[model samples]
Target: MRHRLFEEGKATDCEEKIASLGRTPQEITQSLLNAEESLLNSLYECMRKDFELANGGGVSLPGYGTKGALALMAIYVAYKNGVGPFPKDLLDKLNEGRDSQHLRHIRREKGIRIAKHGRNEYHLEDLRLGKAFSNRHKGVEAATFAEIKAAYGYRCATCGAKEGELHHLPQYRESKEPVILHQGHMNPHEPLEAGNIIPQCQFCNRAYRNWVVFDRNGRVVGVSDWTFVLKSIRERYLRITEENRKIVQELISSLTTQLGQLGEGE
Candidate 1:
């Protein structure tokens, strides 16, 4: 309430001196969570389905299977426990590393709110459906997998990594080995194997899942430009900075009666 009042320029006129009702931080967090219990519950259900689709690999979003989903779940559960979600306690413990990049993308690009908690800690303030996750695991048939592998010279069509297990190529036929190739779709909306598949490494497949689809001959048949994404983020930053500059100017003017010039006297 106080924050809203401050934003509307009515905080100074409020009769209550301090805005807080003397609630503990935990109490406040619990209150916020309680207010949106139904929404968060539904979000967890969707995440569970996405996890099944991606399985152990990434899908839709980069590093999502390895990082983002688990981190967000941890953040969700942290609020349930009435505590802040620290990176080490939640993020690294699940994925063994900090996925700050994922967090930044979701917050800045997706417009999800992440509020800062006490002293360098943070919390997922609100839950928003950012993007649709589509990934039918093993959507490619086994026989087609072999055919695609052979077509790509038993190597990654994306990065040219050998199809066989690492450090066991050239004579890997002598011993039974697991193939490390993935049949990635060039067009996700098309049929699973309607001549729209390309063999890719796990890294490349995951990296280029939702963008940069290519043909078997290493030609980019499908494109999802990331330039627009960068441009939008840059535009948002500029808008926010301009609004902040105006707010700061107003605050300064209110604090002091001096009229300031952009360039002080030639």
Candidate 2:
């Protein structure tokens, strides 16, 4: 049986791009999730093409298909978010893969939980939708969220994004660890601690999970390099915006020149 899931940092061919830019897997996923329209389109197109080629135009096989699945997911998301119409041809091929015997076997054998409202049918739109507020588990105290927001100056501490959510630095879902856990432990699940919480934009916050901090000596450690992480994120954000700015300026110049030529003709 074969099954696939789009885990972060496992997107098709994203590793080479990340390696070429000398970024951690975490950073690459974060950037892709938060990328501007032009960049996101480029990333999605590359992933889509790669997936098609890798899977031989969607010939399903009994293999772990994480890369191709994530590539399709990335493409689907870019199309769904007002970027463009859904690519029906690509979607059709994906549907074929979904109906493959291997996948059917996995679906029947594995207990894939489906929400009651969904009736075992998954919708792409559900990717970005938040869980129902009523169904949400207890999170950090409201007081703590406010305190963290105030401390971070109501901005994403890493990228300086003004609109961001309070994030537990190590994330809360890694284990069944209590919201408050012992400090000075390896990948300690310390949710709600002032020091363990940071402001992060929704995209960056959701890009990765089960995060672990490591030291130069390859030891699992708690969060400590705040200055370094923040500096890196800020630099990357500036770079992305700067590139987009150049593209926008070029587009405007081309349009204005074309309009001037049209006026001369008139």
Candidate 3:
């Protein structure tokens, strides 16, 4: 099944024009998450994930954050709007001060033919965005989910919360109760597989989503470079996770106290 496109009940995608320049993705994204958001900002998170946003380490990997963001948006906008090349002005707003023509250098340096225009417009290769914003996950079998849960000891790979719900074939269910063990993909860029799947608690899944990839050993093998726009959300995720961590600590302390009381009576 295809992943859900819209957040139910709440309408996003304001289509508000981003006329102002020098706006960071974090500011724009937080603004959207907090109140109403423009179309571009509303979808930045999804776009960030699909690009496999990593540090500009290798030649092929797009530069993390702003560089990747601008390129992906170019491809997405062109294909979606039937615009021949993604417009220059739109790309500019995604990252200000850097002239849009740098996309050509980006295309050359990355060794990927993202094809920038002489006039600074850009478009994705062959008119396809592949998986950006597509949210494609080949659904996992119920038994496989059970196995994954067993493998991970039914605990969240991120923050170990013992009792939680098990979710198979991730659809990113939002919950305030934090009652889910997500079957998460190991490589942020790769598709779901038995080898790559890991169990993460709801807090880990939601908070660390799109920003970090956990190895089978539950070690952080890779991290996405932060964009100015994304840093705030990242902070928000960690802040919430910290609060939950404290709650777990309190529970442990209370349980230990009870255990001591029981020993005293004995």
Candidate 4:
């Protein structure tokens, strides 16, 4: 992969020199292309390392097993091309035939709102790649059992057990089945999408398996059905706990007041 850059770098260096003299549309185009290529290469290397560590082996180049790598590459490309922080339409284009597309689509269609900070911009929206990647856990393995444990404050969502392995809510392996578990909103491929992933105890995760999808109020939607369960969970989880509720409410009020003071920023 590094060797592929010799020619690309030479072309980009030439374009850079030309741009330094004066800016032309052709030079600008070349510069953008160079930036895109550089971004893609960097992103790919990161993805490769992540894939190898997650799978517990060095990944072979040019294989179908690296869908996550490909997805990351596509996202890098879109970002470089100025098509992102990607919304649903651009994500659909990048993920045309990939299995991860379904998860991305679902997130775009039903995910909650969040703010994303990028290199040169920020976005606050329901569907955007900046936030998706921003929330991603660094490294090769999918959200490790340890990270999930920490995120949920070392307790299970079901039954509230403090000791257990972090389970992928909707089991990644079983995503293809007609009746899939909607453990949470987290997509296996996009580990950074915070809303989709959650903590569950070993017993609840295993016992429920595909049988215990739930809504925000802990009402059981039918087994293997994730739609209602996700909706319910989001509503329920969005609430602040009694101990922290006042602080959170005060913060929201303060932020709102500050935003209102910033004249013409909106």
Candidate 5:
């Protein structure tokens, strides 16, 4: 089937850069695939459903046989390859009948918490609706959010950028020493407690995911930032030095033992 692959301004800078390397078409394709393995993997995940269906004697190339599917793939490929979302001019020109307002609504509800009281029980009139409980996952109570806002002046605790999502820091797990430290293990399943929650903007929270910072003594002190990276390097150097000291001591002991044996022989 003959189909147009890329549209004007749809080519990403990364793709252009790779193509500019004076490489063959095959080489460029391989480079793009290698650089954007994750994007390709997600696309593959979508393709897999069709693949399974086809195996069961369903429609051949089911997902790939449509224009919409092709458009989505092209857009995602460009976006993941460093081209921003589909150009505004092109989108306006196409007049694809896609509702911009509805898209905004979807974006607004990206991480919003829907109130659920009991298991499989979501009642709008329920008093517990929209209330952030200590055991809830998705969101915190309004009161908890207020406390966070009051603590940080309604700004992001990390960079003071914006009053964003309710990020759960490491939860409180009982340590052997019974000493409560500031940083703890980040358990995703843990309840949303005030002490374990922080107000973080989307940028800071999503930038470096699961990025744990360690202190000189190997304790997780903060997020992955310049300070954390510097401390990690310093910690690595100290560990190497400690290992070298042990090696040097062992070598000296071996030499001393050999010298004593030679003296006895003489």
Candidate 6:
């Protein structure tokens, strides 16, 4: 059976070698778990550094970094520790422990309400208000869907669809007047802004459903593309401008730098 499993490529030669060395299955599993834990810690450190740089040197947890990053890390840790079927209370605890109370306060003062669903659950209304405020304050006109579509050459960031819609990052809530849409940072009512928006298809947009998406290797890619609902925004948007490009560049640089620093520290 072992030979067949190996022949079918289900088992690695390393596993056979470990068996020959007299390591039990439980021991092998433990070793793998340790390795995975080390890897996860390294990744977390890198993410921390990236967030710091992006935020102008240091960001409080739950306030900085992509929400997707934290969520994925929690899931990984739980799985590694033999925790199954993720519990709501544990998730809440993780979120609550990591979030930045200071940042939350600032957001509230700015007219951004942080909606709390449970002990560790929170949502920011006026999701893209930060970007909109910045652009408007910088004299950049509120871009229409057509403008954003033209900027990316009308291609969806995920599937590269030319016929899809423009998506608002940190999407604009329905209650906001005029419902400003397009690429922008999330939670204008809070600090840590810009490069929070991206063009996505309707399917990907709808898949978000208050949850962020992560790639197979555990890095956040963006919202999921399961539903294809973002197409609606494409019909009326315009192209991105040099100003927008600058904002994106800064954001990428900051995140990259922070991640690199964290990796080195780890």
What is each predicted model's overall lDDT from 0 to 1? 0.50, 0.39, 0.52, 0.41, 0.37, 0.39
Off by over 4 Å in 6: 1-142, 164-194, 213-266
Candidate 1 C-alpha lDDT tens digits along 1-266:
22322345554422122122113344333332343545444445544443444344332333334456545655544443344455433344444533344554455444445565554456766443434323322223345678768766888766676765652344543545455787677766666683677777676676666666465444465555556345665888434476388876785686464434433543
lDDT of 5 at 202: 51
Which residue pairs overlap in candidate 5's backbone? 132-141
Taking the tens digit of each residue's C-alpha lDDT, what string does model 5 give over 108-217? 23211222333322111111112222322222234655665555566554544433333333221122122111222132224445445555545444543456532212
Backbone clash total for model 4 is 8
* Per-prediction TM-score to the true structure, in the order listed: 0.28, 0.19, 0.28, 0.25, 0.22, 0.20
If candidate 2 were superposed on the true structure by all CA atoms, what would the RMSD be? 20.6
lDDT string, candidate 3, 37-113, tens digits: 45545455444433433222322344434555455654543443334565666565555534555555555444444
lDDT at residue 61 of model 6 (Cα atoms): 42
TM-score of 6: 0.20
**Model 3, residue pairs in steric clash:** 25-229, 26-229, 165-179
Among the numbered candidates, top lDDT falls to 3
Off by over 4 Å in 2: 1-143, 164-188, 214-266
**Residue-by-residue lDDT tens digits, candidate 2, 1-266:** 11122334465454334333223323333454455656555555554444455444642211334433433443334323323323333333444434322222222233211122122222223222222222111222335566656554566543444542333444533443323211111122544354445545554444323354532122334444445445666887434476388876886799799999999999
Weakest 10 consecutive residues of candidate 1 by summed lDDT: 13-22
Which pairs clash in model 1? none
Clash counts for the predictions, in order: 0, 0, 3, 8, 1, 29
Q: Could you give me the TM-score of model 2 versus the true structure? A: 0.19
Tens-digit lDDT track of model 6 for 170-258: 35323232222233322222232223344455544444433444321122445434233244236434335684788668867997999
Worst 10 residues of 6 by lDDT: 131-140
Error of 2 at 92 (Å): 55
